[model samples]
Target: MDQETAKKLLVEGGTFVFLGVPQETQFGIDMQCWNTDEDFRGIKMIPPGLHYIHYSAVSKGTGDIAPRSGIMHYFQKKEFLVKMWDKDKDDMSREEVSEESIQRLKDNLYNLDRHLGPYPYEIWLKWKLLTSQITAELAAKLSPESGIIRASVELLSTSDKDRPRGVKSPEGSMDQESADDINTENSNEAGQSTAKRAKRATAQEREDAMLPDLKPAPGTALRFTEIPRDKYPPGSTPEEITKHYLDQSYTLELMIEQQEEPLHIIGELQFSYLCFLIGHSLDAFEHWKELVILLCSCDDAIHKYRSLFFHFIRTIEIQIEEMPEDFLADIVMNKNLVYKKLREFFRTAYMSKVDGRLLTMIERFKENLTEKLQWDFTGLDADEEDERPVVVRLDDDAE
Candidate 1:
């Protein structure tokens, strides 16, 4: 931004007043983060729009960091949003500050200005692109009731009846072979062997103990739209149902209907991506992948929602480019879900009657991915042999 623009934002932009944050706490707004010092107060010159504020409490002694927690706030022009840290809870306070206190702070704004950090303007454009479709209403609707998104959700124990029966042991638990080996190695003499067996028995007992069922703490779960289990429409023929499963246009439609508008699907897509990318929420990442798969599986929607698809292509292109290298490697190794889905989408576009403009945009997107990421988009129109359905022919004369 130019000096004039920066000066304008400094005067007109919203202010976030975070009070009583401890030193070394990870604090961020939008895409930027910093470890705070004693002098740190909050962020200023924040561009007024939808932004995610996230933080993780750092342990004083061990330097261990807790799972990240974030909140999405849509800042109005010149807004002054205030929040305080709770020392006892080691989290942001839920209690509201009194108006008198706010006024007193405002009265001493000049002195406090030195402690505030300006929002990083360089990332504003990219951040805006990432969240362009997300509106205030959509943010409110999808955000948790407590308005906080946590990487590791707080869980509450459930009743005995509600707990699952015969819960499977967690991954990396001791197997029977390992236990047998231990038992054999310890069987030197009767008394020592008996003591070892008893110890093993106690260990087994602890392992066998049923853990209580836990659910997310109230008002802390993201309200993403549930993907429909039934992929096909009601009363469809077997062949149509099979076709619906292949294309998933009906399922995508159902998901869109759950939102206020068709474009809100794109909005939710953007919202989920940001939640995962910034908030570091695995739940949000799952939802983001689900949305991506749903969007890429549609054929009819390509024509009906050309604009949405256009933005989606642009949105995901940036997202893929921005993905962490190691994470991208993992995605590429695991059947390359995004690549396969995009191939399917491209195939559908070629086979179906989609808008020429969309086709052009899709071609460009494919080319960009190929050039930058070295992703092969060759033979997209060809169906995989494994995916093709076998057909059986019956003779009419025999019937």
Candidate 2:
């Protein structure tokens, strides 16, 4: 950046005032991360936009970093955001900062200037491309209620009503009454001894027991729109339903309706990708894959939403290229849903009528992937019986 532009940004860009952060804590904004030193404060001259602030607490004694946690904030021009770290919890403090403190910090900005790092200007264009579609409203709607996205979600035991049906409780000693019910006339002594053993178990032992059926702690899970399980609208004929299942156009329509705008679906796609790539959330990765599959499986949508598909092609091209090599290997080896879905999309596009421009872009995208990642898009429509998708239709008299 030129000096004038840099000076302009220094005046107009947002400021983040992070206080009480410990040394060696992993701190990051967007694509960059750093190990904090004693003099480190926060970021300055941040371009006003939706940015992800993520961190992982490092254990001082063991030097082990905890699971990553992040929050998304839309910074306005010249905005000043402040946060404090909680030493006890090894996380950001929930307590609010008073206005007076904020004003004081603003007044002392120059004295603290040296401690703050400038927003990484070099990566700005790439970051913009990755997050272009995400709006503030979209971010708020998809983010967890607690406003934090965690790589590892905290879990808590729930009441029976809250527990999902058909999921068995973790292995533990049975209650005395239940044990009594299990006792046969000849095994009364064994049942009594089992009950005694159960009684003798320590409270800490019970508390520490594995709970595979536990629920995610409230306000921590992402609020992604649920993809319809039925795939087809109600009252459709068996043939129509089967066609819907095979093409997934109706399913894509339903998903698009859930968003404020058709392109917000793409916004969510970018959001989920960034969440996974930067925030290290597997849940986000799962949502990203589902969105990709849904977008790729559409047939009629290819023509109707040519622009959406165009941006999608570019968006996913960058995402695939940015993916870690080991992770890309795993995707290629395990299921390879992305490859299969793209092939299905290409097959549908060739078999149907789509815009010439879109076709040209798709061809270029295919060639790029083939050249860069060595992905084969040849013979996409080949009739492989074993790999072919099966659609089941219920007869009218099935009931």
Instruction: Give the CA lDDT, 0 to 100, for residue 89 in model 1.
Output: 86
lDDT of 1: 0.85
Worst 10 residues of 1 by lDDT: 194-203
Global lDDT of each candidate: 0.85, 0.85
At residue 128, candidate 2 shows an lDDT of 87
TM-score of 1: 0.85
TM-score of 2: 0.85
List clashing residue pairs in candidate 1: none
Q: Kindly list the per-residue Cα lDDT of model 1 for residues 30-71, writing each as its tens digit.
A: 888899999999999999999999999999999999988888
Model 2 pairs whose backbones collide: none
Global Cα lDDT for candidate 2: 0.85
